[model samples]
Every structure is written in C-alpha cells, then in structure tokens.
Target: MAIVDKSTLLVLGPAAWILLAALLVLAAAVWRLALEGSPAQMLVAGLRALVQLAAVALVIAFLANRGAWAFAFVGLMFVVAVWTSGHRVAPSGRWWMAAVPLAAGVVPVAALMFAAGVLPFNALAIIAVVGQQIGGAMSTVTLGGRRVRDELAVRRGEVEAAVALGFQWPAARLMVGRPVAGEAVLPSIDQTRTAGLVTLPGAFVGMILGGATPLDAGLIQLLVLISLLLVNSTAAAATLWLACRGAWVREPA
Candidate 1:
C-alpha cells in the first residue's frame, strides 16, 4: 500500500494516539531491560514531541507570510541546535563555541541553496529545508565534538607525548582527535547510500504523499541527501578543528 493509506489510524483520531503510546512504551521497556535506561525519559520525550509538533503546526500557520517572522523562527532554531549539540559534548559548560562549527557548516550550504533556487526563500520551504540541514549540522558537530572529548580523555598520554616532542598543543590534540571525529559523517554516508533500498526518508515520503510525482520526490530526496553529506562533512571537520583548538577539550577535575 502507498504511504497515504491508513489515514485514520496513522494520521488522526484515537487510534493514532494509542499506537504512538504503545510504540513508545515498547521502546522504553526494551531499553530499560537491556540498558537500564530511564523509561520515564522515553515517555516524557514522546509527550514533549506531541506538544512540540502541535505548537509548531499552530505557529507555522501564522508564519505564512515571507517576512522577518520566518527568518526569526529559523534563527531561533539555529540557537537551539547549537545549544543542544553543545550540551552533548560540554557538560562542564564550554558550549558556546558550538555555534562556530555549526554555522560554518550550515551557512554556506544554505546560502548556496537559496542562491541557486534549490530552496525558495519563503517561510515553510525555508524552514523545512534549512531546518533539516541545521539538524544535520547539529548532529554531526555533536558526534565530532564528543569524539574529540572522549579520545583526548582516554589518550591523554599520546597527546602529551606529541606536545613534549615539540609539536604545538593544537597539533597534538589534532593528532589524537582527527581520526575519531572524522567518523561523524559515516552515518550520513550510509544513510544516503542505502536510502531508497533500505528506507524512504521523510522528505521523499512526504512529497509523494503530498501529490508530487515519484520522480519529483526522488529528485528532492537526492538533493537533500547530497546536501546533508556536505553539511555533515563540513560540520564534522569544523568541530574537529575547534576541538583541536581546545574548544571541547576535557577539563581536569
């Protein structure tokens, strides 16, 4: 069946709520059993998602005009992305630097897309495409930053040795951090490669359900995938560079 099927159960009404709650409960149970994860966290996250999506829908309806409101909302999203990504790597409060790498990754690609008309500069389309790219940047930078933090903590001696051998402190960090941080883009690469065969991504499926031809949906999906690669790779590299400069270096207790 096409994805548009199961409208009543999947899209609205009581069945949708029940099914979502059931799935969340099942996931929480499995996680709690295997990893002692907090089931409450899972439940809360689901609830938060429901509330946030509802809020987004209502807010987006008011942002139909192409004006300052659209750009302001996207700016808010960028700030949130930076904060969220930094929290993952810098629990000790050195997170503000996260904006650098994330901006480095997102700005260029977004400008290119806007300039090339790949994404129109309207409220809905701008948010949909730029938000996705910003999310990609956030995730990549988080992974890359965390890897740098962990590797430096674990391999402190290696970094120290390089430093003692007359290498600069930044270079020493780079020697240890680069290898691990570089793996940040691996997921994007894998997802792009196995996209249509293993899974239909949200953009492609959404467009198809919205009445776009399959070919048009596929092209859009392809564009999103390629753009994600650029965003992920650039963000990861910038994160690594920033980490090497001591942005996310593990602090001593």
Candidate 2:
C-alpha cells in the first residue's frame, strides 16, 4: 500500500469533513439536552483545535530544520500545557501553580530518556516524545487538581477535624484529598493494561500503517504507555500536593 499518495489525501479530506459534521450534530444534541452554552463551547473548542493544529503544522515544518528552534518549540509547548492545565483546574488565582506538577512529571523522564539515548537529540524525535509526555502530564494534573479540590470542598469538615487533631492544615487537606486525586491516573493504568486486547492505540496503528513490523510497533507503543504511566503518576501526585497546599482553594460562597 502506498503511504503518501493522492488516495490517502482523498480519504483524509472526506474524513475531516465528516468529523466536522458529526461534531456539529453532537454539539446541537448536547445544547438541546444539557446546558444551552455547551454548543458554543463545543464549536469554539473544535475551531480552536483546527486552528491550533494548522499553526503547529506550519511551525513544525519550519522548526524541523533547526535544532535550537525545535527545543524552543518544545519549551513553548510546555508553557502552553502548563497554562492549559492550570486554567482547567483553577481557572482563577494561582492557576500557575499547575506548572509544578507538569514540570515535575515531564522533566525527569525527558532527562532520563536523553541520558539513556532512548531519545535521539533530533527535532522530530524530541517533539514527538516530549509533546506526548507533556500532554499526558497536563491531563493528569488537571484531573487530579480538580478532583482534589472537589473532594476537599465536600470533605471540608473532615479536613478541619484532622486539623483539630493537630495535623497541619496541609496534612489535613492531603488526607482528605489523596484518595480521589489518585483516581486521575487510573485511566492510564487501564489503557496500558488493555492496549492490544481492547484497543489498538494510535502510535501502534500509525506505525503499522507506515509499514513497521508488528513487533516494532508494539515495542514503541509499550514504551509510550510506560512513559505515560510515569508521567501521569508524578503529575497527579504533584497536583494533589498543590491542591492540598491551598493553591487554588475556593472561597466560601
């Protein structure tokens, strides 16, 4: 099968249009059944994703030739990931605290990959690996942060009681928030366990489609999944810590 040809482009063209139409229909259904504001939100998210991806494609084309520019691009991606996760979790003051968890998860693994020569010092390779790791960390951080905040709010009395029993405020909050915060990483765990059985992940499928052997694709996919586990676990733990430390505690209404 020819990988890069007119037929591939033809298929992608229709697929994109069909996806857009489906999104519109789904947005309409959501608006009619749920919040009236959701349709606009959905449309906006879709449009923004399209624009962002186009822009990234252009940027990647330019950056692929320059090692320094590629590193800078990755840095920009990290910053955006931090801002996005922070906004999703906190949406108000001190949302920047999200940077801690994102960095905590991404930096160590990235460093180790470089040191082990698993990640080549090349533009495309660095972008692909680091981008996925950053994205995974961002998702886990946001999930853990939001869950901890909600848990803290619901279990405020328990936290107070712990404080009353001489636990520090942070410790009290951690005690209340830890259980649910860990739930953020459960998806990663489940996906890793069920990868080839229940679902073929994109990385594996893409590699196979690009003519890689099944064994090679499977190995790469395993590496990606294991890397995600490390990233999400660290990020979730950090997010919980930040939440317990009152990084974005809401004021009583």
Candidate 3:
C-alpha cells in the first residue's frame, strides 16, 4: 500500500489513551514519591514525545518510499545519535569528537552488510536495521563515555600522580578504562540473556503480531541482538580509545 493508504490502527483512541496512561503514571509516581519533578513537566514531556513520535512516523513512511530520502533519514539518525550519545557520555564541548568512534562502529558494519546484500536495499528494512544500529551506537557511546569521564573525574588525582611519575595517557587510562568498559557492556549482555525469558523485545513481538512464524521471529530477533552486541562492543572500544587519546578531554577550567 502507498503511504497515504496505510491505516493507523487507533487502538482505544490514541491521544486519549496516551493522556490517560500518562496521568495514571504521574499519579502513581506522586503517590509513591518515585520521582522529583512536577507532575506538569512529566505530562508536558509525555505529550511532546507523543507529538514528536507521530510526526516521525509520518515522515518515516514518506521517506521509506524514496531512495534518496531514506539515505538522508539514515544520515540524520546517525548525526543525532552521535550528538546525544556524546553529550550524555562526557558533557564536554569536545564531546562531539566522540562521534568518531560512534561512526567507526556503525558505518563499517552497516556498509559491509549493505554491500554484501545481507541487508536488502528496501527502504523500510534499511531504516529498521539502520535505526537499530544507531540505537546500539548511541547506547554504547553514552554509557562508555560517561563511565570513562566519571572514572577519570573521580580518580584524577591518582591519574595525575601516575602521569607525574611518567605514566602516559594510554597507560593511565588503561588503569581505569577496563572497569568502565565492563560496566558499559552490562546492558547489552543482560538484554541478550533475558531476551525471551524476562522480556519480549519489540522486533520479535512486532513480527509475531504481524503473523510471522515463531521461528522466523526468533531468528530475526537473534540477528538484531547479535548486530547490537557487535555494534555496542565496537562503539565502546572506540569511545575508550578516543578518551584515552585526549580527543574528548574535559575542560581545564
């Protein structure tokens, strides 16, 4: 079907349902004292996210039909992922340099898969896989970046002491980097271990809902998970290398 002909299955009045769910969640948070924000901010953020997702959904559908548009959308996703991931990791103005490792992880694998015909050039599938890769890159970069920054900040004195004694940046980083990288891998490792037992990932559930065979859904989810693991590991390594190289250093002031 063409984009215009696709029906939005409004299960239980979309906006009203979302609003009710947000209200319920806000009420529960307040009742339980689970959060620190004003309920109004939560409500506003929920509404804004809903609006943004709706707009993105429409744009994605349109972009999926145009080859050039699909590539453009992928580029945009990568740029946003890099910026947000970098900001979350180190909070340095030079955090943008973290994009190098993020790209290092994503672009190589994505290019290989696309070139090898493992990932079809279809717009929808391309978008889906690219989005997953971007998400993986973002997660790795953000977690690893923050961990490294926090580690260095908390141990700067020790690091400086080592440096004073003639230890280099890479050696000083290695002293703390291993632990941070280990922590950064926990999310992916946990998600993989808990995939079908404790949680049903979106891709698998969506495929089942769309009438895919259980085996097929399982295989697809496996592919996604494996791809994510590789991407995350690569991104984490890249982040560590860049941070060690002083490319993403905190400001001296």
Candidate 4:
C-alpha cells in the first residue's frame, strides 16, 4: 500500500503512535544522558506535538476547500509565528515588534507565488506553502534576533568602545551583532546544500509517497528549499536591521 494513502494512516494508526512514543523515549533518554537535560521537557514536547497535530488536523478538516478562509487561517498562523518567534528572541514582552521581520520574509515570496499562479489558491496548497514559509521565517527570526540580543549583551564593551570612539550605539551594535545574526541563515543554507545527500526532506519524501514522480518530487522540494532560503536570509537580515534600530537591545545605554 502507498504510504501516502489516506487509509494508510488508519492502518498504521496504533503502530505509528507506538513508534512515535518509542522515538520520544529514545530522545528523552538521549537528552537526559548526553546533555544533562530534563527528560520531562522532551516528553512534554512530544506530547505537545501529538496534541497540536491532532488539533491542527481537526482544523484542517473544516478548512478544506474553503477558498478565502484559508487566507484567514494563514493570518492566524502568522500571528502565532510572530508571537512565538518574538518570545524566543526576547521573553520580556517586546514581542510585538517581531511582525516586521517576519513579514519581511513571508509576504513577498507568498505574494509572488500567488501572483505567478505557481501556487493554487486552494486551502490545502495555500496552507501548506505559506505554513512552511512562515515556519522558516519564524525560525530564522528567532535565531537572528536572539543572536543579536545575546551578542550585544555579552559584547557590550565592544559596543561601548565603538561608541566611545565616535561611533553611534546603533552602528556599534550592528557591527558587533550583525555577524551573529548573519549566522542564522547558515542552517537553511546547509539544509539546501545537503538535501537528497544528507537527508530526504519531508516535502520530497511525502510527494514521492503520494505517487509523484521522482523528478516532480525533486522539483517541488527544490522550490520549497529555494523559497525557504530566500525567506530565512531575508528574515535574518531584517532581524538585524530591526535590532540595530533598537527593536531589541539587551545592552543598556
């Protein structure tokens, strides 16, 4: 039976659940032993994944074939992305400013895809496409923004030294933090570079299982990867720009 068949999920149902639990236990064990991390955190994350996916699946059931309502759902997803990424960057309630860089990454690519007729306006396609892009943007924003915050915090003296030497704080902060912020895109870069060699990404594997030809799967995966690269790099840069402009500064004046 095809892995992507609708009934396959039901067939594999209990087995899949058990497999996921086993994997979670292994991860939790590794976390506890290798990193001295809390096993509870790992297990909790697994549980959250189960619950959240179930909830999302339920929502998608209703959202199916609901043309413009999909956009509304995307808006909801964007808000969650912004909030989560913002909190990740700074937990001190400056989270709202995350919208700027997040938008910088997600919107242009989405608009381009829709306008170019590359992506259908259907609920499934729109949600899948924009959801992944938004996820990419969120991760990059969190990484870049947090790097800027933490780097500026620890390297406050460098910022001060630059400021003392006739440079402005913003410029000095940028000089110190931009490099770290720039590193945020390295993950996406490496993922793109190593795709098919190091790992079959979910999109590629899923499409293949869904009966798409290998070439078609590869092309779609390439498109997804390329789009993520654009969104992530742009988000990282925009995060840096926002940080330099003082969206978040862990260093005191």
Candidate 5:
C-alpha cells in the first residue's frame, strides 16, 4: 500500500471530540502567529500527523497478535525516524550517514536489554523499548543537528579565525560545537534530574496502570531513564563527529 492512504472521518463519537480539539489547537497556533499569516500548511500537517498516528495505532492493534508484525513495525519506525532526522540535520545525500547514529545508539541498548533479560523479547516489550529508542534518537538528532547549524551561522567568523590560527576543522569547530552539543543534552538532563519531582514519566505511570507495584514502577522508570541517557549520549557523540567532519557543513550566505 502507498505510505499515505485517503481516509476520512465523518466527525462522530470520540473522533468528533478529537477533531474539535485539533481544530482548537490549529486556531491557537494560528492566532499565536497572527492570523495575518496563513496556517493552511500547519493545519494540513497536523491533520496528516493525526491520521498517521491513527493508522499506526490500528497497525499496532493488529501487531499485538503477531510478533513478527510488531518487529516489522518497529523496523519501519526506525527507518522513518532516520529519514526524519536526516532531513532535519542535512538535506543532502550525506545525510544517509545518519544511519550510523540512528542505529548505533539504539541497537546496542536494545541488544543489551534483550541479552540481559532486562527486557523481554515479546511484542509489548519490543514496542516499548523501540519507542523509547526512537524518541531518544529523535531528541539527540534534533538537538545536535540544529545546534551545530545555528552555531555555525552565528559564529562562522570564529570558526574561520580558529582555522587561520592553525586549528584543524574539528578543533576549529570545537569552540562552538562542544558548547552547542553540550546544550543539546540539557533537556534530557533536566528530565532526568526532575523525573518524579517535576513530572511522572510514562514508564512509571504505565507500570502503575498495568498493576505493577510502585516499587516495580520506580525500578522500570529508573531503567528507562538510564537507557535514554545512553541512547542520547551515543547519538550526540556520533552527530558531533559527523559535524566535525563537515558532513553538515555550512553554506556561504
């Protein structure tokens, strides 16, 4: 089947409520931006995202009964994730190299979880871990990529000055790169530091809802926190290396 299918909702039941909520959000975003500007694209994108999610939910509902389907779905998700990260990072052929960070960061953690039996190799467990991996990678990629690009734009002269002073590309970029990449980690760090105090993470609430004890929920949340750190760390490191190599080099203004 084509990636996107033509589908419609007649706006009834819970879907009607959801559509109302979505329209509200669209109106809010447009109003925030000043309705002098068109939000047609934004509305379309929002609708697309909602439909895509609905389709995925339907697919997962079926996958719950088939382990292979779940695995395949996870694989497809990773592929789409890499495509998205690459597009945002470097809209060029070289972006394909993002496969390294995308896979390297997520796969090992997943492998370790399965090997150590920390995560069962079942449909639900795989889905959960894979979801976490994709989310972590997405965060890292967006942070690392956007920061590097923005820093380069703001500090191109600094980069050139360093290069003129005999610094190699990597060393020259380090002045802006290190700090930006470091900042990229702030969200994850803040989330970790304030996990329970500021926000109850999904894992904890999910475990509780699933009838697990609070102790079990706490342990699972802790494990998830650690796992996300590893995944993001690896992705950021890989992204930094790619940036240093000028894989995402800035174009002249």
Candidate 6:
C-alpha cells in the first residue's frame, strides 16, 4: 500500500479522533483515581497535536516541491522543537535555554552527515533526517533538564553541603544532578540496543514498505539509531551542564 493512500488516510481520519478520545479518557481516569490533574493537559496536548499536524501536512505539501524553501521549513521545525522542549522543561522565562542543548546536539551531527555525504544535501532528505535528529535531541533535553531539576530540588541540602565543602557551584550542582540527568539517555540506549531483536523502528519499517531492500532499510535504520545516540547523548550532556550552571532552575517561592 502507498504510504498515504486513500485507505490509509481514511483509517487515519477516524483513528485520530478515536485515539484522542482514548487518551482523554485515560487521562480522566488518572485524574480521578490518582488525582494527577492531567486530563486538561491531555486534552490540550491532543488538540494542539491535531492542529499542528494538520498545519504541517498542508505546509509540507506546498513546500516539499520547492527546494529553496526546505531549509526554511527545517529551521522552523528546529525552532519549534527547541521552544517546545524548553517549555516542557521549564514553563518560566528560562525555557529558551533549551535552544543551546538542542543546537549543540543536532547542528554538529547534521553538518557532519551532509559534509560526509551520509545524508544527501537535498530538501527532503535534510528535512527527514535533521527533523528526526532534532526531535530526539529535544526529547533528551527535556528529559535531562527535568531529571536534573527535580534532583536538585530534592537534594538541595546535598548540593549546599558540597558547596560549603569548597566545591564550586557548578561542581556542587553536578555532583547532585549529573547521575540522574544521565538517565535521560537510557530510553534511547535501550531502543538502539533492542532495535532488531525486539522492535523494528518506524524508519526501517517505512523504508521496507516504501519498496527498499531489507539490507538498505536496515542500513538506514542503523544510521538513524546511531545518529539518535549521538544526538541524545549530546543533548543530555549539554542539558546536564546547563542545569549545573543553574540555567534552568526555578526561582524560590
């Protein structure tokens, strides 16, 4: 079947609403049982995703054919990803700090991929690869930032003690935050390690469904996995460093 064939679109049309409803129902259950107050967030996130994805679909349809517009589109995606990640980590003014780790992770890898001819320097290819990399980096940054922030908040005494013991502020913060922040990469590590044995990622399955050879698909998936490792690790490290420097800490109440 074609990737976006009529049948697929038909399935997606209903599936979207059904999935959104299911998510809201699940969130409501959590809210009622666990008193988590997540139902409203779930509803808002679901609606936002629906609208944003619809917009992206229309935008891509128009821009994909225009080679000159590809970079602009990719840049927009990066900016949005950075903003979303930043906000996810910290809702306050420091949310923009996420841009540094995201760029640190994605830009270097994307540049190297293009320069080494691993990724074709074309609009579609760049968008596909760099978009995924940016997304992975964003996830890592969010995870790492939240982990470090929470750890520092909980272990404020430990950090203070280390500081009083002559450790610098950054070192004291890292002493308390680095270990937990490092956990941010665990998911990517597990996904990569279990790629073929436990799960076939979307890139591999999509390539095969798109008529690529299994070997080619596997190679492409491997590249994606490796790139994700680089991106996520860099993002996690950068986020941890930033957290150590108090770049994303909330003000005391």
Judging by TM-score against the true structure, name the best candidate. Answer: 1
Candidate 1: residue 3 lDDT (0-100): 42
| Superposition-based RMSD of candidate 5 using all C-alpha atoms, in angstroms | 6.5
**Residue-level lDDT tens digits of model 4 in 48-113:** 988989998988888897978989989999999989999898788578888998999999998998
Q: Give the least accurate 10-residue stretch of model 5, judged by summed lDDT.
A: 1-10
lDDT of 5 by residue, 141-244 (tens): 87787788778769989999999989997888877787778666678888999999999898788788778999989998998888888888888888887887
- lDDT for every model? 0.87, 0.86, 0.79, 0.88, 0.79, 0.86
TM-score (all chains, Cα) for each model: 0.91, 0.90, 0.84, 0.89, 0.83, 0.87
lDDT per residue for candidate 6 within 121-155, as digits (tens), equals: 56777778988999899889988898898899899
What TM value does model 6 have? 0.87
Sorted by TM-score, highest first, which candidate order results? 1, 2, 4, 6, 3, 5
Against the true structure, candidate 5 reaches a TM-score of 0.83
The residue pairs in collision within model 1 are: none
Which candidate number maximizes lDDT? 4
lDDT of 2 at 116: 89
Q: What residue runs in model 2 are displaced by over 4 Å at the alpha carbon?
A: 1-10, 14-19, 35-37, 249-253
- Candidate 4, run of 10 with poorest lDDT: 1-10
Q: Tell me how candidate 6 scores on lDDT.
A: 0.86
Q: Measured by C-alpha RMSD in angstroms, how accurate is candidate 2?
A: 3.1
Summed over model 3, clashes come to: 0
Please rank every candidate by lDDT, starting with the best.
Answer: 4, 1, 2, 6, 3, 5
What is the clash tally of candidate 5?
Answer: 0
